[model samples]
Target chain A: MHSWVDGQPVDSVPLKDRGLAYGDGLFETIAVKAGQPLLLDRHLQRLNEGCRRLALVADHGVIRSEVLAYAVALGDGILKLILTRGDSLRGYGLNPGAPVRRILQGSAPATYPPAHGVEGIRLFPCATRLAEQPLLAGLKHLNRLEQVLARAEWQDADHAEGLMLDMSGRVIEGVFSNLFLVRNGLLLTSDLSRCGVAGVMRAELLAQAQALGIPVVVADVSVEQLRQADEVFVCNSVYGIWPVRGCAAMSWPVGPLTRKLQGIVRALLDI
Target chain B: MHSWVDGQPVDSVPLKDRGLAYGDGLFETIAVKAGQPLLLDRHLQRLNEGCRRLALVADHGVIRSEVLAYAVALGDGILKLILTRGDSLRGYGLNPGAPVRRILQGSAPATYPPAHGVEGIRLFPCATRLAEQPLLAGLKHLNRLEQVLARAEWQDADHAEGLMLDMSGRVIEGVFSNLFLVRNGLLLTSDLSRCGVAGVMRAELLAQAQALGIPVVVADVSVEQLRQADEVFVCNSVYGIWPVRGCAAMSWPVGPLTRKLQGIVRALLDI
Candidate 1:
């Protein structure tokens, strides 16, 4: 693995980094292929927005250049970028002008069962519920204990992901990806203003669906509605998109819409 | 400062540790006086309970030994113990039997104005709202962005702490401490079943209050109730206790109950 801290090669970070102390940071996982980062713009956009919302000072241009350099050095891998509020006194209060720490690291791309995408995958209904906090919603901040617990809900390889519901029982998203349901002819996904990370691939798919003249509706999605969908799938920037074949007792075939979107993503990333 | 990771001296942790990646960890801030740890058993008990709730395996005996040794080495300082699920693959899924990382670090005790405990401190009514997550409530986990943002709400030295409220407009806690309202002859604090961390000092105070034959109530505390309290104070193991003198248009004088608890804590810690 290769890594850089604040544009310099480093093996570790300061123990007092806010990223580890209070998770006062943000992160982006980008798919790198042949020294190129896929959906770089979207990832950077989300990171910048997260910094703005969290009131952390960050240099986007410097971060972008460093990420690109780290990705190029790795040649073909998965690049993860972590931006933290840097070190501060032992308290929640931030030091007004503390330096922002940016870490770029590269690892080999994940190897998932090929059948997961072709034959679709099963999902477990996670017992962990996402709390509704609009103030921190939609931003991919580092406070992800919710995701950590939800991801731990299932252990079987058959289940590629887990579905998380909000406190109100509204279907929010998957353990590490965004959820989407194709009903009739419209693409429906949960509105993330209340909770859940606004995933990069989810945004790309929504735009692609609109460009393809498919109706898209972002609203509060119910598990009942999800069970009745014509097709369902989960997406993230790293893994692209994986169709959902079964969740609980309900089963779904890889519908035409899911296949088409998969094709679009594959072509866009040239995978 | 002195530090250790998994019983070995270390200055940094792996960048991919789940503690930094997803805040999948628990921390205990301990107060050290002379050469002994204050409330050592209580801190470890809470840490064990948090591990049980979060499904992280931790050997209480071993951790207790390590923490005690580290604290004794520091002699006079604040000791912080962080137990994380260690490094894992890129996804949120655990590595089944991954080693749990234990980090123990000591820093000099914080220096606040001596008048904070005597003359009382001011609080800023934070705009940040705590999300209700019962599954994660009462546990002092690493996912502390909410507290970080709330603490950033006020930078003035006069506003010693920020008052955080839950989504329902119920006063939850101070940014770095648990809140208590002294009304009539009773002590009232917010119930932690829905939100907020169950601080070690707060629990001790409750038991002490009961032993002193003072009525204590743990329930939803509203902002209006807080404003009308006979006296208000915040407590944490690190700083012990600080009475509240003002918050917005409301002001409070340090009452007898506040002074009594302060005296009890001072005696208990022998500070």
Candidate 2:
């Protein structure tokens, strides 16, 4: 892997980094193609919001330039950017004016079966329900044991992802992706105010759907509501979109809405 | 600082390690005195249980031996042991049969004001509530952004620790310690089934209280109940225990029960 910390080449991160100690960090996984990072602005925008919410000072200009330079050098792959509150003593208290550490690493894009996009993918209804924390919701901070546990729920290749729900039994998102339901031609997704990540692709889809004149509603979505949906899909910035074939007993066909969005996402990434 | 990964001396951890990437790990902070680690058995026991809960394969015997060897060499200090699911690709999915990474780091003990133990410390009512996550609860996993945020709520040196409540408005714990309330000579603490760390010190206190013939109750502790209590205190393995003098509008006296436990704890560690 090619890596850098705060623009300096480094083999590993310091053990005392707050990111490793308390998961006190924000991360972005960008899909790189032909030496270009897709949706770099969106990723940085989210990272900026995360820094604001966490009350950490971040130099977005430096982050943007560093990420672009790093990705361009890598040519084509997946680039992960982790911004931590820097190393601290053995306590929760933050060191005054601690420098923010920006780590950029690149890896080859993971190969997935084409069928995942064409024929859609199966999802496990993960027993690990996400806890409602509006304070930390929507930010792609490093505290992600919930997702790790939910993803570990299924080991079978037949299940491409796991569907996670909130404690109140509301359908939240995929283990690593944001969820969307197309019911009667309207784009519906869970309100992440309570829990779940609001992925970059999810935000793009919402905006694109509005531009395409497809109605969108950001509100509470139930399991039964998902079951009744005409089409279901999951999306992430790295993988684009994958139509949901089945989640537990409820099976979904790769509907026209899912295909249309997939085409748009492909074009978006290809650029 | 002295550090090691997988029994080999190291200065830093790989960025791809799951502990930094996804907080997929457990940790133990132990107090060492005169070439002896206080509560080595309890820390390892908790780590083993955490491994079981997370389904991560751990060699507890090896961990126990290494921790003791490392601590005894250091003699008197604080030792932090991090057990991660090890390095993996950039995703929530685990690498099957991946070796678990054990990280041991030792640092000098933290110095706090002597008044904090004798006169008690002030507490801040944190707005950041602890999310109810039973699966991840009670385990000192790396996912601790909630506590980081809670600890960040106070800038005043007067507030030694912030008191955090759950989403349901029930008092949970301090940002880094387990909370207890003494009401009518009975020790009351929040149940860890929903949320909160089951600190080794809290466990030790419970056992010692029972041995001392003080009634103990592990149940839901509301803010109102804490206000009505005669005494309130917080305990963690690293700092022993600190009595709570004030939180919001409710004030507590450093009652007899708290002082008794403090003396016993100091004796337990000193020997």
Candidate 3:
């Protein structure tokens, strides 16, 4: 893998970095296609919002230029940008003068079974639940132990992703992707105001769906509601979309809405 | 600062480390005096439990010996041990064969206002609430953005610590310490089974208080109950104890029970 730290070609970050000490950072995994980063604007907007909410100081213009340059060098691959609150000397208190650390890593494009998209993938029902913290919710911050634990719940090749629910037993999202279900004709997703990452793909899909006059609902989705949906799918910027065939005992076919949205996402991702 | 990564004298960790990636790790802050690591057994026990809960494989014996060696070399200071799930290639799924990374860093002993321990300190009632996650509640895991946000709530020197409550509006803990209150001559602390760090100092104090014939209660503590307390204090491994004088509209005297427990803790920490 090729990487950079603060615009310098380096593979390591200081030990005192708040990113390592306290997970005081935000990360974005962008898909690179033909020397260009896909969904660049959406990722940068989210990063800017994250920095503002966390009171982390960072130069967005610099980050944008660096990521663009990094993508061009890699040609086709996955680019991860990590923006940390920078290093501190053993404390929760922030150093007002500390510079924000930006790390960019490039790796070969992720390859998964083609059948995952052509056919469908089973979702492992994770017992771990996402805690409600509106302050840190929606932003793809570094504190993601919940997702780590949830993903660790399954090791077999059958399940492509794990379904995670909020502590209140409300269906939230997939371990690594945003979840959506179709009921009648409406696209329904969990309300991330309470918990879950607001994926760049999810934002793009919502905008494109609305532009195409597809009804979308962002509300609290119950397990029963998910079970009753006509179709289910999971999406991320890198993978675009994957139809969810079954989760544990309940099953759903790859309905037309799922395929239509998947096609749109594929075109958007240029995959 | 003197630091070691995986028993080697190094000042940086790989960018791919899960500790920096997903905060998939645990940490312990220990106080060292006269070449001895204070409460060594307690710290190791907590680390072992954290590893077990997170399904991260680590050898406790190696950690104990490494910390002992690190502490002896430092003589007197604060020692921080960070155990991460090593490195991974951009995913939440655990690398089954990946080795756990152990990092040790030694720093100068913390210096705080002497009056914080003698006269008392005011608690800043933080607006940031701790989210309840039974799976990740008590363990001093690396996902500490909540504490970081809570600590950032106050920039003035007047407040020594910030008070954090759970999402359900229950008094949880101080941003970096565990909280305790004296009510009707009964020692009470918030139940960490739902949320909050189970500090080694808090555990030691409870055991010592019980041996000294003090009646202790570990239950849900509401804001009203805290306001009505006769005495209140906060404790952490680094700082022995700090008497709580006021929190917003409520104030409490440093009662005899608080002083007695404080004395025991001070002696135990050899401070």
Candidate 4:
């Protein structure tokens, strides 16, 4: 995460940045290595579409240019880009005329989960439920209290993730990633058209699955269906692919397809 | 407003404040004058409950003392107090071991909506729909993009507020305040057990009406009901009572009961 604000690095942001005020912002966490941002275009595209969906103004070309310049200087690390609607006189109503702010702060050492693309992760079903709001389903806005609470449900750092369910106990996604299950010789994942982050890696996994000619079903899933799966895995742009094993009690081994997907993504990183 | 972090006026906070990260925070905007905060306890109660619900660790008395000290220094303005889960290492999980944060920052020159409590406001139905999540129903956490986009539905300065509907097309709340309508002398407002802010003023109005022998019903309302109302008004602790003159060409006047409630709130404010 190279630090830059509107193209310059700043140590602090105004406390009242609309991101703070209304969670009125978009963010993209890109995987970085050696010194370059991976899947940069995909992250930027989602960020732009997010801004458009919320009617926030940001020049994709300008932000992209700045990100590249900033990353080149920082060497290897993850990049987290946060763009907020700048300070406005206190009000819920938009200052349609207000300038949207760009907060490019924090360039930290990029570290992947130690078990990533290998031994995999363990997840527990969380009692905290996510609301179904299609308007906010896919956009990576800053209003993330649900994820915070759901993740906080467990204190064991060994558990890498928590699978959140909606009010009806329908499976949604991991706290930060999308979920996929292999059952009955088919590939299935929860549809995020209602509530969850539309992760960049999840998008790639879907595309690659289609290219592989696998049977993929995007629909509502229940805990019962998840429990009966032969294999399970979670994915996000930063983590790439992580198999899920022993979701508290049920266990799953890293499957063949999960490994093949990981190989292609690894090749991209090595490139 | 006076600026403080855990009772001290700090020059800067860590860039990693949870309020900025996961928006793991809660805030209260109060109308203050003559070195006193209006309905301070209600605001404090909401903030305290939010902190507990979000698993944030903090002493309530400390927050009370800090906010009071800051409010006393500023004779008039809006006091915005934010209690966040505080800064932590990278993860969606809460910092169970992290110290809580209290952000007391606002300008003393700030005033409530000019037309809100005086001449009332005009509103229009918003197209953005809120999702029903009982788990997150009324706590005013920082996940407010739903309201942000709804508030952005228009940019007219004269249009003081916009009324929001749930995905089911049921009327819920204004962008910030609670909604109320009068029909046949019955006081009606949207039930927020599923959506919208459980506003401080709305609670007080309910209590005030109950004490005054007026009937209050928390029920599902529709646009037609709003359009057919004899009178309409919106309220929040900051702006006591704002009458609605029109909502999408439907005209209403300041109802007799609304004016009476306004007088009651004004009396309390003068205290």
User: CA lDDT, every prediction?
Assistant: 0.90, 0.90, 0.93, 0.80
The reply for model 2, stretches above 4 Å from the true place, is none
**3 or 4, which is superior by DockQ?**
3
On the 0 to 100 scale, the lDDT of residue B177 in model 1 is 91
Tens digit of per-residue lDDT, candidate 3, span B1-271: 5699999999999999999999999999999998899998999999999999999899888999999999999899999999999999559988877899999999998898878999889999999999999999899999999999999899899999999999999999999999999988899999999889999988888898899888999999999999999999999988888999999999999888878887888887888
Residue-wise lDDT of candidate 1 within B103-167, one digit each (tens)?
99899977878788889998998999999999999999999999988887777787888888999
- Clashing pairs for model 2 are none
> Candidate 2 deviates by what RMSD?
1.3
Q: For model 4, how does the per-residue alpha-carbon lDDT over B1-271 read when each residue is reduced to its tens digit?
A: 3378777766345657778776778888877788788888888888777777777778899888877777788777878888777776786866567788888875755455666667888886788898887767888888888888787788776787888999888999998889999999999999988888888888888989999999999999998998899889988887677888887878998889888888998887662
Model 2 per-residue lDDT tens digits across residues B7-92: 88897998889988988899999999987889888888889899999988988888988998998888889999999999986588
* Model 3 C-alpha lDDT per residue in residues A113-153, reported as the tens digit of each score: 88999899999999999999999999999999999999989
- Among these predicted structures, which one has the highest lDDT? 3
**Residue A171 accuracy (lDDT) in model 2:** 94
Q: What would the per-residue lDDT of candidate 2 be over residues A186-259, giving only the tens digit for each residue?
A: 99999999888889999999999999999999999998999999999999998889999898899988999999
Candidates, DockQ = 0.88, 0.89, 0.96, 0.67
Best by TM-score: 3
Clashing residue pairs in candidate 4, if any?
Answer: A1-A78, A1-A79, A1-A107, A4-A104, A35-A75, B1-B107, B1-B108
| Candidate 3 regions with alpha-carbon error over 4 angstroms | none
Which fraction of the native contacts appears in each prediction?
0.88, 0.87, 0.98, 0.78
Sorted on TM-score, highest at the top, how do the candidates line up? 3, 2, 1, 4
Sorting all predicted structures by DockQ, with the top scorer first, yields 3, 2, 1, 4
Question: Regarding TM-score, does 1 or 3 come out ahead?
Answer: 3
Docking class of 4: medium
Cand 4, B chain, TM: 0.94
